[model samples]
Target: SQQGEEDPQALSIQEGENATMNCSYKTSINNLQWYRQNSGRGLVHLILIRSNEREKHSGRLRVTLDTSKKSSSLLITASRAADTASYFCARAPQGGSEKLVFGKGTKLTVNP
Candidate 1:
């Protein structure tokens, strides 16, 4: 499958703490993206990292990609209760279809 597998199916943390999630895939990809989804809501794009990039950051989010290992990781710094959501990793194939394959996701809960 082109979809990635996310680590830690569930995570719970206190507010203001950092949260980290990992994703591993089997095949090569063009790019990998992270998305957030609140309960009963559509996903919101968080960040994307190209195959050539080793790391990238936006706001409180940090993403790292390792093509050699076909893996990636997302880090949310100083998380808040509002950050509680399911985070998914999606990948675009190197070629062919433009469709993206997504993982089940990691459920994060931040307690105040």
Candidate 2:
């Protein structure tokens, strides 16, 4: 079974605004990762936060995880048309295989 599912499914925002996407999962996780995919391109690693960590930030991105709620969220600050893409959440199961289960993803459009 899939371990993670992203919320909202889609988001549209104007440039300079912030975009937020959420994810919920079942079962324990070793870590959770957020990925972005541009149209007709492969997924790119965005950020990864471990189960022991509550939050992490990199560049214009911020991520938070709440194991108690089995949920996580990704925040993209200062929206730009270049930031428009599909964002996915993937989880690495605790003591499970190396593979990460991915959600359907949330499509974000940043208008200029």
Candidate 3:
């Protein structure tokens, strides 16, 4: 079964606003990562937080992980219209699966 799934499947905001999304998972994970997809093709890696880490940030992105709760959240600050895209949370398997289970994703629309 898939290990990760995101909540609030859709989001909309103005160019200058921030966007936040949440994710829930079913099992233990080695690490959790966030990716952004433009249109419907390639996925661009954003940030990653290990199971032992509480929070991490990169540029305008912030990620938080609560391993005890098997959950994570991604926050995009100072959003822009170019940031509009589909964002997904993926979990790295605990074992040596060498595969990632991705969430259904949250569609974010930043209107200019």
Candidate 4:
């Protein structure tokens, strides 16, 4: 496999607290994207920080990249019950394919 799966299949946090998650993958990549999925809603594009970029932030979402370590982290500041969902990291491979192969995802449950 060209991609490595993320550890900690699930996470739970209290409302108003921050949540952090990590992902690691093997091989080279052009870009990695983070997505969020609610119970009924489809995958919503959260953020995309390229391999060369170190970090990017959006409202409550913050993403960091470490190419040397082949890993990335996501921090949600002051999470809410609305934030309860599954988060996934996907990569657009270095070469050959154009589709993003997604990880199994980390299920995040925020208690209100």
What's the CA error at residue 29 for candidate 2, in Å? 0.2
- Where does model 1 exceed 4 Å of error? none
Per-residue lDDT tens digits for candidate 1, residues 5-111, read 99999999999999999999998899999999999999999999999999999999999999999999999999999999999999997886579999999999999
lDDT of 2: 0.95
Looking at model 2, the pairs that clash are none
lDDT of 2 by residue, 49-68 (tens): 99999999999999999999
TM-score of each: 0.97, 0.97, 0.95, 0.93
Candidate 4 on 3-97: residue-level lDDT in tens?
55765689998999999988898878898899999998899999998878999999999999898999988899999999999999998778767
Total backbone clashes of model 4?
0
- In the predicted model 4, the residue pairs found to clash are none
Q: How close to the true structure is residue 103 of candidate 3, measured as C-alpha lDDT?
A: 92
Which one wins by TM-score: 2 or 4? 2
Candidate lDDT scores, in order, read 0.95, 0.95, 0.93, 0.89
Q: What TM-score number comes out for model 4?
A: 0.93
